[model samples]
Target: MSFVESRAAIAEALSTVEGVTGYPKRPTTWTPGDAIVLVEQIDHTLGVAWQVTWRIVLLLSGDEGVAIEQLDELLPLITDALQPLVYVDTATPEAVQTEGGDMTAVVILARSE
Candidate 1:
């Protein structure tokens, strides 16, 4: 599939996760609760196809402690949801600060051909 089509498919796949609120193509406005943001990290041309590495960020809202706990709960679900479509590379916990408050993000690296 083309890059745009590939990304759209990834977003559609992520939409099926039970606890996820939404999968946004870009990180513009923050959603009220939990949401998934997809960012294209890198791309390599593999002859006729391109291998794209995507940063699947799970934005979690609430207290730091609770958000960390929630990351543990949600990481596997996100990975499972993406398994059939992409190769999950790594998942890491991150702390993000916004004007509103502190938030947590589980940044997952996934590769798609």
Candidate 2:
């Protein structure tokens, strides 16, 4: 699928997940990738948007910071959500920011995992 299509698919999938997971509904957006910043918006809660970076997609959960090991366990769940749309390269650790609120995730998908 094209970038926009892929983004849309991912976003749709995330919405379903949110509904089933009982997470608050949030607005989302996507930016076309070029030479830099190859990312697509998956979900957005508040001003914080969940994005998929090209090189790597970092995913997180819980109110407190998640450890690397814990993150590893969560990858399959994300992959399960994304695998149907397209191939997703395994997620990697990116910047984990805990500034104003609880911990969230930013998944970066290159091609497939």
Give the alpha carbon lDDT tens digit for every residue of 1-113 in model 1: 76667667777777787767545476566643455546566555867766788777777765778777777777778778878888989988777777777677777788988
Q: Whole-model Cα lDDT per candidate?
A: 0.71, 0.44
Candidate 2 Cα deviation (angstroms), residue 69:
6.5
- Whole-model alpha-carbon lDDT for candidate 2: 0.44
In candidate 2, position 67 carries an lDDT of 40
lDDT of 1 at 16: 80
Question: What's model 1's overall lDDT?
Answer: 0.71
Q: Write the per-residue lDDT of candidate 2 for residues 37-98, one digit (tens) a residue.
A: 23543444466544444433333543335545455565566567756765665554544444
TM-score for each model: 0.80, 0.45
Among the numbered candidates, top lDDT falls to 1
Clashing pairs in 2: 53-108, 56-108, 57-107, 57-108, 58-107, 87-112, 88-112, 88-113, 89-112, 89-113
